[model samples]
Every structure is written in C-alpha cells, then in structure tokens.
Target: MASIAVYSVKGGVGKTTLAVNLAWCAATISRRETLLWDLDPANGSGFLLGVEAKKKRAAQSVFTADEAPEKLIRKTAFDNLSLLPADESIRTLGRQLGSIGKKKRLAKLTETLAKDYDRIIFDCPPVLNELSAQVMRAADLVIVPLPPSPLSARAFETVVEEVKGSGRKHPPILPVLSMLDMRRTLHKQAREANPKWPAIPLASAIEQCAVTQQPVGAIAPRSAGARAFAQLWTAIERKLAAKK
Candidate 1:
C-alpha cells in the first residue's frame, strides 16, 4: 500500500481538506480501500467524514502498545473508506515520539496497516517537529497544499527542506495549489507560475464539505471542485505507478 501525507509548514493551507477529499477520491473513484489517518489534533478529517473519535486520549497511544489502532479506526459512510480519527491528545505526540527514542515508529505502524489498506492518507499537523519528522519517514509521497499567497512559496520550500532532511531517501513532494480562484489576478498569476501543478478551485461545493460532511465528489460529482480532486488523484496514481 502507498501512504500519502497531506502536510504543510503553515496552517490554514487546506491540508486537512485535501487529505479528506483525496481519501474520498481514492476510495470512491479509484475503488481503493483507503484509510484517512488524522494526525492533527483538530480532528478535521473525522469531522469532515461525519465521525468523531470517542477516546479523547487514545490518538497518541497508537504509536505504542498502549492502544490498538484497529479498535479506534471507524468506518465512514462512504464505501471502501475508513478513518483513524485524531483528538486533542495528539498535540503531545511530538514529546511522546521523542521520549520513545525509536525512529520510524510511525513507519512501523503504517507497515502493519498496509495489509488491510490500499491507500493511507495522513492529515498531518502544521508543525516542524518530531511528529512531522515521523510523518515524513512514514509517508511514501508528501502532498503539500499551498493556498494562493506570496508566503506560500516560503512554506513550500520549508516543507521541501523538512522532508529532504527527514531521511536518507525521502519521499517525493507534490505541491498543489488550493483555494485557487482564477478570477483574481494573484490567483491567476500563481497558477501561471505553477502551470503544471494541480489546482483545486475556491468553490462553494468545496467549502460546503464542512456543512455537508461529505466530499465534493460525493456531493456534487459534476462540480469543478470534484473534477479537480478526481484528476489530481489520477495524477497521483500515475506518479506512484511510475515510481514502481
């Protein structure tokens, strides 16, 4: 199974939204048994899936023998999709990871889950610490969502450096332009600069994900937002295949 991490060094870049939507694309469009693993404390991924983790402190326990992730993992209403939700307890994950003194602990856990899943998407927190380090080691491909802004370039570079410095052979990074609105000059210019990069437009359908508790594709399959995610997933699949 391939593990994909949707991460950013800056917050409010739509990392969780990307993770959830891509997970839906993988499961519903690609027909892959996908797991959306929320490593962020906010648990936005679960909220988007219309599920919430009951054990408030159990999220951090999955890294050790203290908790079994299989028990915590809950199936979503969408077919072929499941969620390993996060809670506020994950905020201390960096400290817990450092104390354990085991590098690649997250990677080991992902390996165990590989037997049951075709795709594992991590909704990583927007931080540059041990938790992010562990995610870098675990992820096969790191997807960075960059909202159209001048500061986005710096954030993208920061993520590149983090992933590169994570391990000897780090996972490849894919930068995606999120919340893009071509009608705006800045957004149009940003797209022009990164013409090859996949772009998810700023649409009511995408924003309605929170209100509807469903992916854009599931709710409005004909919408541009849904098409963008589907195309991006297809591109990701091709990238994975090429790597193999």
Candidate 2:
C-alpha cells in the first residue's frame, strides 16, 4: 500500500480539502482501496467529508495505547473510501508520541494497516512538531498544498528541507498549488512566472464544498475544479506506480 500525507506547515492552505478530494478520487475514480486518516485535531477532513467522527474510538487511540487498525477504521459513505477519524483527544498526541520516539510511532502504526489499504492519505496537523515528524516518517508521499504567495513559497522550501533532513531512504514531498483564482492578477502572474507550477485553480465548485459537503468530483464532475483534482490524482497515481 502507498501511504500519502496531505500536509502544510501553514494552516488554511487547503490541505484538508486536498486530502478529502484526492482520497475520494483515488477510491471512487481510480478504484483503489483508500483510507483517509484524519490526524489533525481540528477534524477538518471529517467535517468536509460530512463525517461527524464523534466515536469514542479514534486514530489517536491506536497510537496513545494499543488498538488494532481494523478496530479503529470506520467506513465512509463512499465505496472503497474508509476513514480513521480523529477525536479532540488528539491534542495530546504529540505528547504521547514524544514518549515513544516521534519518528517511529506513526510509521509503526501505519505498518499495521498496510495490508488492508491500497492508499492511505493522512490529513495532517499544521505544525512541525513531533506529530508532524512522525507523519513524515510514515508517509510514502507528502503532498504540500501551497498558496501562490511569497510566504507560501518560503513555507514550501521549509517542507522540502524537513523531508530532506529526515534522511530516509524514501522521502515523500510532492508540492501542488491550491486555491488559485485565475481571475486574480496575482494568481495569473504566479502561474505565468512559474511555468512548472502544478497550480490547481480555485473553482467556484470547489469552494462550494462548504455547502455541498461532498467531494468536488461527486458534486460537479464536469467542473473545472473537478477536472483539476482528477488530473492531480492521475499525477499522484503515476508517481506511486513508478515507484513500484
């Protein structure tokens, strides 16, 4: 199975949105047995996907104590898409992980679920703390959603440096531009200036996720945003397949 983390140091860069939509595409469109694991305490992925995730058992339970992966994983409304929900208790996960050596905790937990999933996408917390380090260690590919701004670029650099610093045989870092409005001059210029930027346009349909509570592709498959997400999933699949 391929483990992917949708992560960003800066919050509100559309990381959760990318995680939800991409996992949906991977499961529904690509037919992969995908699991979207919410590691963020905020529960943004759960909210966006319309999964309340109010269960007493959570992802942190698997790490804080000992719990089987199947015991914690909850099936979502979509076929082939399951969720390992996050409870508010996750706020203390960093502390718990610290006690167990952050680098290996997440990797070890994920190793248990590898046989059950073809793709596991972590909707990670927005910090470079112990928890983030653990996510990096566990992930096969890290997708960083970057807004088109100078600070975002700098943050992107930091993410690259962090993965490189890990010195793992395989470091997962895939950067994608998110929430881009082509109508805005800055967004247009940023795209033009950086010809190689994998910029996913900010489409009206994507923004409608707040009201629709569904994946962009499911809400409006022919929309521009849906197409962009589909293309992004294709890129991700190719990258993972090439590794195998």
Query: Highest TM-score, which number?
Result: 1
What pairs collide in candidate 1? none
- Which ten contiguous residues of candidate 2 have the minimum total lDDT? 52-61
Candidate 1 lDDT over 1-244, as tens digits, reads: 9999999989998888899999999999999999999999999999998998867779988987788789899999999999999988889889888988988899999999999999999999999889899999999899999988989999999999999999788999999999999999999999999999999999999999999999999899999999999999999999888878
Please list the residue runs of candidate 1 whose C-alpha ends up more than 4 Å from where it truly belongs after superposition: none
| TM-score against native, each model | 0.98, 0.94
lDDT of model 2 at position 154: 89
lDDT of 2 at 205: 93
